[model samples]
Target: MSLELYYWDGLQGRGEFVRLALEEARADYVEVVRGKSSEGLGTAAMMALMKSRDEPYPPFAPPFLKDGDLVIAQTANILFYLSPRLNLAPSVESLRYVANGLQLTIADMVTEAHDTHHPLASGLNYEDQKDAAKLRAHDFIDHRIPKFMSYFERVLKQNPAGDTFMVGDALSYVDLSMFQLIDGLLYAFPRALKRFGEHYPRLAALHDAVLVRPNIAAYLESGRRIEHNEACVFRHYPELDKAAT
Candidate 1:
């Protein structure tokens, strides 16, 4: 497995989505940032790759996968590429697009979740825009969460193969991602989640099912699973969360 994954050293951020898929497959890959910098395969290498002009398809940021000569960036895109090869996607070619679309929708929800804390600007610290974040968070928890969570519930109900997974009969990368999304939502807005989780019973069930998977369960308990922090996406602030207040 000559796969090298480049993401931030300390935080899971978007890279964790890709990591979940790889972990589920038990794929041998190098998480560059987690390794020792002295080995010349660290965050610095990832940073250098981002600026490399020699590469044909230059990645704009971290959370990129380097598979032999092919370098792919973006969490959803990388998952779309790897899921099929790793046997983490639907066998049907057409359904692959549906899986990718769901992954992209998850990405949208992630962006909204991230902006809830850094509502004004990603360049600024959450403290700098606390007021805006409060407003953004209120709207996110009150409005956006329901919209997205309900949408996923519908997706699950209409899954054709039943709501066992996000896409097809087996667990795809999209399923792993939705589980991550639900986990993040619970962390960032536990109060809102508790109030609204029941309405999306199917989605909640999917989350529970994914959590118990042997590979996912092991990876989560293992040292590789980075805990949620204020610095990463889905920061939990007491004031920002409706239930906390």
Candidate 2:
């Protein structure tokens, strides 16, 4: 089975969630935008592909996966499609639904995370929207982060399978996504993250475990991992982050 993933060539952004799942499962796939020989056909090329009317199942955004004739979009949707096939989801229908629901919740939290830095406008420069960002960041750090963390902590605690994963005894795509969200928040807001870290030990441990997974470890060390920068969703302006506390 030939699989192709198209997204911005540099930063991980939302695409990294899908990438992490594929990597963790050792799935065979090609990162189209990161192809070395065709340097010019990078992120821009991927965007063009999304907009092309000639392509069937044209994706509305990046991070879409192509496997033969099937095309899937949206990070949660992509994971929902891949999870069962890759053994990254529970077998029972109810368990799978809960896992997908958890993934969707993570997607909402990610959107909120992105908005903390770009509250007013995603296209505008951080400097232009610093004040708005500060307000948003404060709300996220003080309320949203803790609220979401508590909810996830409850899910972990209540799971009949125990504290190992979001859904069942085995790891699921939701687990990887939770790890990504935690890592992003840590990178983008270390000070605020520290304040909330002790409140969610299970979530913290999950993040650590996912990082050490063989494929994830290699991905982090191979220079394929992009540094958090202003261009991406999670920007770290000192003032906004500071104001969060």
Candidate 3:
């Protein structure tokens, strides 16, 4: 059976991380919300599953995965489960855990990125929270970005296997997520990320490397990949973006 991915339509959001992994592995999966309603794979289908009382493990939000009868929620959780099956994880058990930790950290950074624009409240609009967002975005670009990017940069530089991949000597799901994270940050903060290569050379290299992978390159060029927009986690508001320096 094909794996079912339940995520919101019209935006990359958190789901793009999972999508990146699947695309890299050339995995056969169904994007539930992106499918046609006539095929029982659309927004209504995703809602039905979410609202189903008979479900033993109900998902709290979108970006969940359904494989057979098992349901996995959360971006990191979904990637953790799929990575092994997709051969996008290390063979060593301990290293797999380390990869999971890295993925969760990426998730944390993603949340921080989201909060920059929605610092006051997720329920509030950017226009309404413009004042607080500017402050939050300033801190994000000045402090958080460097802190997180530098850590990942160090991780790559310190990797015993090599500096090319995040875990082990080969590319894993974590690498894919990192690529998406950096790509989103670049899209959302062109000014802030202008000097990314100069500071975080390892991360910059990884991002460029992932962009050229056969499957990844094809997926990116295809219509399947959704463009980042204001509605997603990484929004580019000119007033909220600035150079870290």
Give each prediction's root-mean-square deviation over alpha carbons.
Answer: 1.5, 2.0, 0.8
Deviation of model 2 at 230, angstroms: 2.3
* Model 1 agreement with the true structure over 155-182: per-residue lDDT tens digits: 9999899888988898899999999998
Give the alpha-carbon lDDT of every model. Answer: 0.88, 0.83, 0.94
Stretches > 4 Å off in candidate 2: 36-41, 243-245
Task: Please write out the lDDT profile of model 3 over residues 48-152, one tens digit for every residue.
Answer: 999998989899999999999999999999998998889999989999899999999999999999999999889988899999999999999999999999999
Per-residue lDDT, model 2, residue 153, is: 89
In model 1, where do residues sit more than 4 Å from their true spots?
A: none
lDDT for position 5 in model 1: 92
Point out the higher-scoring one by lDDT: 2 or 3: 3
Arranged by lDDT with the best first, the candidates are 3, 1, 2
Model 2, 26-60: lDDT tens digits are 88888888776466446667777788879887888
RMSD of 2: 2.0
TM-score of 2: 0.93
Q: Candidate 1 or 3, higher lDDT?
A: 3
Query: What local lDDT does model 2 show for residue 74?
Result: 89
